[model samples]
Target: MTVNQQILLDNRPTGEAVESNFKLVQSPLPTLEDGQVLVRHHFLSLDPYMRGRMNESKSYAVPQPLGEVMLGGTVGEVVESRHPKYQAGDKVVGMGGWQEYSAVDANVPGALRKVDTTHVPLSYYLGAVGMPGVTAWYGLVKIINPKAGETVVISAATGAVGSAFVALAKARGCRVVGIAGGPEKCSYAVSELGFDACIDYREHTDVKTMAKALKDACPDGIDGYFENVGGYIFDAVLLRTNAFARIALCGMIAGYDGQPMPLANPALILVNRLKLEGFIVSEHMEVWADALTELGTLVATGKLRPRESISQGIASAPAAFLGLLKGKNFGKQLVKLI
Candidate 1:
């Protein structure tokens, strides 16, 4: 019998999740049935959406029930396989939850993607060449509809999705400015990530001041906005957007922690002719291969860079996840399994 370690939900988080909300436990693996593959996980993605699942409220997606393994995306190697499609030594990516080992049906719905990691790092498949990058691609291209020489602004600009937007927008000849939480991330966005300019929202005292800074960066009104942290940042960007501007509503990291919602900006929508569209990435998964192929090429050529904020062990996943919610991660956040 093989023992696998997994993080179980000890309790639902009230506001910010503490370490006590999760517990690591070991369990014996069951005999694998036909068409099943035993996977040993290597890396697990820690995303902002996981926080929503920790709650029991009705959401766009169903919440994970109490006492079940916490949900996550992972890259794993097929160590033991009764399935003909998978053999030993095949690397795969899937929605594998938080565990050192798991049994997955070979035909499990949305379960796996065979990976060839010889060129790009294996971890990159879970990040820039994977979901977050595709999310940015569809959000910016299909929803935001950025034009050449337009001014495009993105919040949480140094994060996985935001950084990807910076690269894609730049490729389209649009000027890009990033909004981040600190001087370091601001610098990272501009200097390292090749953004035209960056604003440190934490340095600004008020939304109006942030609006002024963003305006100063653009010198013209914003044409496209890829929204991630959408409270004060949304208000700030609203004040600066040009007529007929489109906003891709990617995430509202600002509202994820149960904070009081910021007042809406209906006046700007009326005056500026702004179009805000909310999107769920799963809606575009059918066309994911084309998006991933383009993103992977960019990563392979170094035109796109993915910063990984990796926690060393599965035991640290709770703390790492909390850090991501708090904007401590520099880029794509993940837990590296030993």
Candidate 2:
């Protein structure tokens, strides 16, 4: 492709992100250097983390620069390559951002890597067998560390990371109870994702009701927790947490749009002696290979079937992403660039 269509962060969000915050632009695809590769991206990953990057405020990572392609993971074909390690038609994954093509300096380690699609689908590299999968694995295996027969709870249970977390936790013999927004997602968590039970947060709008639902679903008490959405749902989980329970503080989507989401009961941490830890999966890259191995096998063997909500083209990214923040997208959201 000679021209690259791109999404640029036009401005930071005031509160909730809107389409106007992003601008669609066209530019000549960058000319590749001798050690660079030109990749034609087929799929671009849309994730909740991108919301945090939209703000100019300090965060776990730097804010995405204005008038540049919005950053994201992508999988595509290598249409042209001048690097010795890569060649034309090679299927690869990289941080190709929000664009149809990327001129990558392949010599930069981890910027580009070939993927095998023999058993696993290429898109799965963006969700279940990729970053989301590794996020689930690290939190459960490294942080929570639940034992067999213990009950573990996850919020945003049907989401990309939550679905993977459920599968991985189930494999370790933990009773996984999921918390999702609506009845549909709750049912899917149990019937499809194999959660022991799933509490619909819609019905239980407050802490008491949600805590009661947790009490019923996890009769044994929550021994581990993988948190995504915070706010009252997290408060309810805290009320049901067992002594010395481990908790992985992942995404707090409930507060992502500049909302206040403070813990209702901070004393519970001391009362329950909770071991809560927040992490960035990228910082702990050492476990990626091992995590991807198990996650790939799960997807390849039909053990972990991840759902996806794919938008048709790059132009749809802003709207699709806005929908994702509103919980409209079911699972891993992507923009199909091809």
Candidate 3:
């Protein structure tokens, strides 16, 4: 029997998460039943949404149960399989959580899918060519619906989802402006990611100041906004949005710390005649195939360049996740479990 190392949620955080909240333990894997496969995880995705799952309050998905495996997306190889569809050495992506190995039921819908790593890296399945990529596609194509030559602004611009949006919007002929935490990220957004301009949010003292910077950066006014950080960033964007502007609300990392960070200007939404919609990507599974196809092609062809900030092992996941919450990660955050 193979020993499976697992990270369990030891306790829910009241405010910010710490390493103490997670407990790593090891257990022997059970014999596989028919229609089951044993997977040895190679990479684990650490996303901002995982913070919400730690809360005990009601959320879009169920609160992750205490003492269970810390929920996450993982890519791995099948070591043993009783299922006819899967064979040993097959690489697959699934919700394998924060563990070294998982015994997954092959019959479950959307539980696992084979991945081709010959062209694209296996880690891309957790970020650019995977869930985050599809998320950016859904928000951009379905909600924002940006037309050619329009101005698009995105926050957390160098992050997993936001980086994908930059590429997607730029490809559609939109002039993109990015709002990031520092000079390095802002520089990357403009220099490496093909953004028209980028504003360093840390350079401003308040929303009013940031709004002025956004106004100057977007002289044509903002036509479409992709919101990731919600507090002051949302307020600044509200001040510069053009009439009939659309905002795709992807995430509010600013409010994840249990702080009261409300939007400062609801009246702007009315005055600007903006259409703002918040979304959860997992609920829309129909578009995954198309999104992945396009995203995969972009990455493989070097059109879409998604970056990663990877930590070494499962034990490092908690600190890495906390660092991500603190805006320390440069791009998509992942744990290299193998």
Please name the candidate that would achieve the greatest lDDT relative to the true structure.
2
Q: What is the overall TM-score of model 3 with all chains considered together?
A: 0.98
Per-residue lDDT of model 2, residues 1-338, tens digit only:
57999999998899988899999999998888899999999999999999999988889999999888899999999998999999899999999999999999998979998999999989989999989999999999999998999999998888899889988998999999998879888888888999989988889999999999999998889999998889999999999999999999989988888888888899999999999999999999899999999999898889899899999999999999999888888888989988
lDDT of 1 by residue, 88-139 (tens): 9999998889888888888876787799897778888888888888998998
Clashes of 1: 0
Predicted candidate 3 versus true structure: per-residue lDDT over 1-338, tens digit per residue: 46888999999997988899999999898689999999999999999999989999887889999999998999999999999999999999999999999989999999999999998999999999999999999999999999999999988889998889988998899999998889999989888888899998889858999999998889999999988888988888999999999999988888887888878888999998999999999899999999999899889888888889999988899999999999999999999987
Point out where model 1 deviates above 4 Å. none
Question: What is the Cα-based lDDT of residue 134 in candidate 2?
Answer: 99
Ranked by TM-score, the better of candidates 1 and 2 is: 2
Which ten residues in a row are the worst by lDDT in model 3?
254-263
Each candidate's clash count: 0, 0, 0
Give the least accurate 10-residue stretch of model 1, judged by summed lDDT: 257-266
